[model samples]
Target: MGRTTWFDDDGLKKGEWTAEEDRMLVAYINEYGLGDWRAMPKRAGLQRCGKSCRLRWLNYLRPGIKRGKFTPQEEEDIIKFHSLLGNRWAAIAKQMPNRTDNDIKNHWNSCLKKRLFRSGIDPVTHEPVVNVKATSSSTMSSPTLTPSSSTTDSSTSSARLLNRLAAGISSRKHGLDRIKNMILSEPRQAVKEDKLMISSKEDEEEEVNGCFMEIDDNLISTTSLDELLCEPYDMYQSDLGHEIDDQLDLFLEIHSLGQDLS
Candidate 1:
């Protein structure tokens, strides 16, 4: 029944962090930058472990950390953000300034859970509970396109990625195939050809089918996806340039799910 109180060593202080502890920890951090977590305790003359110190500073003692009851608008934003991200508190917290991941998570558990249920909405799925049951019934009676909450979430993420890339490419067009085509414009033909016939060895073929494809043309050294990415293609280039791998990964994931990403 022993707990992970920073470690089993009872020498380190546990439970609540005191005012003096907070003041000392903060003063040390201010005078000298947060150099290393493990070494901070001894340098600051604190009885607390590094992990505890770190969490305390981040969640409670951190400057600019917003406190008090969340406003109505903030509550609505949290619900919308939860629907998209689920339990990714850190991701949800990024949209919100002056808020910690721990704070957002606590608010959801204490306040939003009851609020969603009061509205007859499933807190986990963010869908109407009655509608969920109705959807389930119609799905058995006829064909319902709406998937379960889990599947819907994954599809939502993928769709967002596609839409983001498409928006970067063109304001008007966002058809799935068009975005897929532009994403695969690098070496897509060679990838399709690889499936039918292989000019390269079987061992090397797997590497050919990644974020980018290489045909192993003329054995003039295997070209990398980096090389392909280095070259500019207007359609695929945008503010989303940094997220190319993420875009590619999602595209590849959907392709693996039996969709023709060509």
Candidate 2:
């Protein structure tokens, strides 16, 4: 092959970055603030190409760049936002501070697409697909109900048969109508369910507090109301304890709800 007629003089930096290379780039950028990268190497005394220096600074040395695995909330936010924004990955990444566009893009391809499909939504359209059963039923049900009954002869018999047919169809329509209502109303139903739950919880809290107040009244009758009220003042003085207790109570309630929902 004659080694493809070799030529020697090189200007471009190749291969992976070493620790010393990283340190030098970081230190140079930090100390001098990035000037022209095309001229940065010669100015900063680095043995790297401009492209290499630019990539290192952008992908690694940039301040406020978040690292580590994203939390579930971040993942959800990214999905929801991208669902709205499409592939404005950089804009989506901006909203989720810890996530890069590259990371978000990868997660969308690897994970989010499956999640969307599993949730009954088309990943591309973000719309729910009608199930096969629903489609078939709708098609079959649409016919059977003709506009005129009198046009067919045998007046009495036709009337009775028409009534029966109408009833059967009305019943089927009512059932299918109910199903369609459920399908269309699911999102609203979820909102209403949440509201009802919150209302019920508030009512429960009110009842519990009323009982607690009755107990407190009895305690005050036996002891002193002023002393009991003042007890909490000294109790809240331990800032760490107050924080811990609040967190414990919140976690307990959230844990109960999570278990119930699951």
Candidate 3:
């Protein structure tokens, strides 16, 4: 069946309605109740179309219609509901008792949508917008340093080991930055990835320490008692060498216990 046209052949009134037209619409609805809107203008002596009349009555002249600015709670709920339901304004209106779908939609487009964008949030997805450039720049600026050359001398090797330790700290800092980006961009995935990264790093540390323990035990056990006694006196000659000896001792002690367990 063809849909009945509510608009008149000569075109019904299109602009702002007069006070008399408002009164007539209210009077007609009150006396006869809201019947078929298509035939309403003719019966009520109104020049407006059925759609216009319906909108005017529902949005403006309807009882209990809160016409003022929306409250903070209503604004919050609209954003929350819109995130869950998308553009289902009618469904959103159901939760807001005094609001219409049109008002809710207008408020979102005019206000909430822009607000979300400004706050780095994707209105459609309701997720934080990741700044790719920021992440890239941060990572590029903090390049991980590597040992420039290899040497068999114990002093040079110790210096390289210290450099590698510093590099490891830098790598962990980068890892933390990536985690921060993930959290902002995708929270649920970030949580899972965070757990996995922590566990993997822990396991890596254990394996690395196991290897270090074996190396440390071999180095300590192979050294002559005379070298051990002389090394401390040699370390005392310079502050830098003293620091190196102290660090090496601490590192070996920590890993030596791990060797016993193996």
Candidate 4:
């Protein structure tokens, strides 16, 4: 047998498919039924690559294909599956019987992503966006005074410190929430460090105050609190000392102001 013409060597047509091309593709598929994609375009007498022909038919010309807007349920399903499956568009498409991967992917990029972002949800991670700047600035710049060493101390001192720092600053609530969320979102090691810092009364008051002083020194020396938080910290060290001190000072100032008013 002579060499079979598998595909046309001519430059394949691209961009918008003509009305005539659609009819040709539809007619070819109707009569012959779908076959090998690589040879389909050549056999159908279309100046298109097999891949292009395949996409056109599957995404547009296929029987029972839904071409209108997706339903609300479909939209919810897309978001739900996207959260679980990430950008596996084809896998997400399969969950909706009548949808195509291209349609779902387009919808996500064009509409869903913006919608989620505006709602304060990270569309990719499907989680609330931590306002790191707000948290870092509020915590780093404002120093709160700790109660005098004579005041009651307990294993829960760290927790008390956070509460005191947040006290009397109604506007700082958002920043405090962001910090709590960040701590919760951190790995188990960070969680453990948080507990240790809160519970560790092993150090003498002098040692603890010395450490606080060192952190204050660093905060005074550094220009950017954001950079400091992002830097690597030793597993044993709590990186939030300066922030705590700032909050502590603010707390004490607020208390003294209340006393002065009284």
Candidate 5:
């Protein structure tokens, strides 16, 4: 919308109003009440348009209008409403007590939009941004799951919706598994390629069987570390069977590579 004309070639007062103007508008409304906005300015003794007078009364001079910073709960409600109702500011205002449509719209535009963006969310769609800090396609962006994951729209049947939801999750999980398998398919090579050159310098200083041994003593002490291990977290180093270990390695590889899971 273009800037609201305070005056249209008719020389009627436009733009910002004076203290006396507000006083006159408020006084007139207090006495006659709000009805005919086109005639209100004339009766209110103001040179402004009826639209201006009405807006000033309702948005500012009106009683019960919320002023100052929005509370946490109010901000949350605004976000929720925006996500569901889009940019329908008046509709969002109905959900919030004392908050006018203009105020909510202003707040969303000035504050919430920036806040959402900084938190890695697209304020318009209200979805998590996917590796968005990078501007180029070659930046290796990760995919983010969003409400659009489902194939069906809002008009879809319950069974179709459920199937789409299941399908979306399955597709994501399968993609992750494929990447994982690719990395861990050469489990031996991956382990072998990790060129960590440990030597006798790392041997534990302990008297084993009353004899101060070296590498053998280190091996004996290494076995004790396995007792400290637990499932999932320690799975890589623990004695999961060959097949289970391979799967676990695959999962960890995918996870380490930053493949998103739904």
Candidate 6:
């Protein structure tokens, strides 16, 4: 036997719901409360499907529904929750009080993804998105899980090396404090290097043109030797002559060391 449809020919007024239909629905539900949603449209004199009416009332016409742009904090919470929950928008929305699942999904697709990309995060993976310093697409994928077992092995080894370096530094030791200071000083050191490079280049150009510009050795510090060695760092060695092999080695070592320590 064929399943009978709930909607009757005489039951429906057969068009979009009017103000009268909405009022009737509101009055009926207020008096009787919602029961058997498939039977609601006929009982309440609405033209729309019972499913459609229920959705419209719950999502759009609900008394305490909030309809507006999400605040920055709300957006951040949504992103954090989404990173953990992975598209369970309904569950996330429930925590957001008046916000709907549809709203959250649209915001993620249209806005949040761009924000994540701008902040150097992989929107899909929710991990720090780094530029590939190497040429191969293999380098584009995460070092932890690659098609090449050798690559994975190398990555693991590199992580161990980094952990050793980290373990070598103790909080009570002056060496650890020195390293922390060095790390914090890196940006300032970079800016100083840029200024020195620019000044040196300008002086060289002036000298070649039979003019003189004052050169100052005091402008460049001898203290930041490591940072100076890695000056003008860019992905794929755009500024410096960073080799693809070197880049791969660096990444593998870093990843391996990280894993080892953890």
Error of 4 at 238 (Å): 43
- Judged by whole-model lDDT over C-alpha atoms, candidate 4 comes out at 0.52
**Superior by lDDT: candidate 2 or candidate 4:** 4
Model 1 scores what on Cα lDDT? 0.53
On residues 1-262, what C-alpha lDDT tens digit does candidate 5 reach at each position? 2344466687787777677888888899899998999998887778888888878887889999989999999999888666544565765676785999999999998999889977876565465545522223333443322332222222323222222212222233334454345334543333223211111212111101111111112222232222312332244223223423433343334333322211
- Candidate 4 per-residue C-alpha lDDT over 143-162 given as tens digits, one digit per residue, 9 for 90 to 100: 22222242222322333233
TM values, all candidates:
0.54, 0.42, 0.48, 0.48, 0.51, 0.44
Q: Which candidate is the best by TM-score?
A: 1
lDDT agreement with native, every candidate: 0.53, 0.46, 0.53, 0.52, 0.51, 0.47
- Candidate 5: residue pairs that collide: 6-14
1-262 per-residue lDDT for model 1 (tens digits): 3333352466888777778989999999999978698889899999888998999899888789999889999888888666544565776687686889999999998989878866776564454444322233333443222112322111133223233222223212333454445445644454443221111223222322321221222111232334433433233345223434444554344344222332
Model 3: per-residue lDDT, tens digit, 103-199?
A: 8989999999889867766554354544422223343443211112212233323332332222222234334244234334543332222110011
Lowest-scoring 10 consecutive residues by lDDT in candidate 4? 191-200
Give the 10-residue window scoring lowest on summed lDDT in candidate 5. 203-212
List ranges where model 6 is wrong by over 4 Å.
1-21, 132-262
- Deviation in Å, model 5, residue 88 alpha carbon: 0.6
Q: Count backbone clashes in candidate 2.
A: 0
How much is the lDDT of residue 215 in candidate 3?
A: 30
- After the best TM-score superposition of candidate 6, give how far the Cα of residue 214 lies from its true spot, in angstroms: 58
Name the 10 consecutive residues with the lowest summed lDDT in model 3.
191-200
Model 6 C-alpha lDDT per residue in residues 110-157, reported as the tens digit of each score: 999779867766454354544523323343432221111211111222
Instruction: Name the candidate, 3 or 4, with the larger TM-score value.
Output: 4
- In candidate 3, position 156 carries an lDDT of 27
Indicate whether candidate 2 or candidate 3 has the larger lDDT: 3
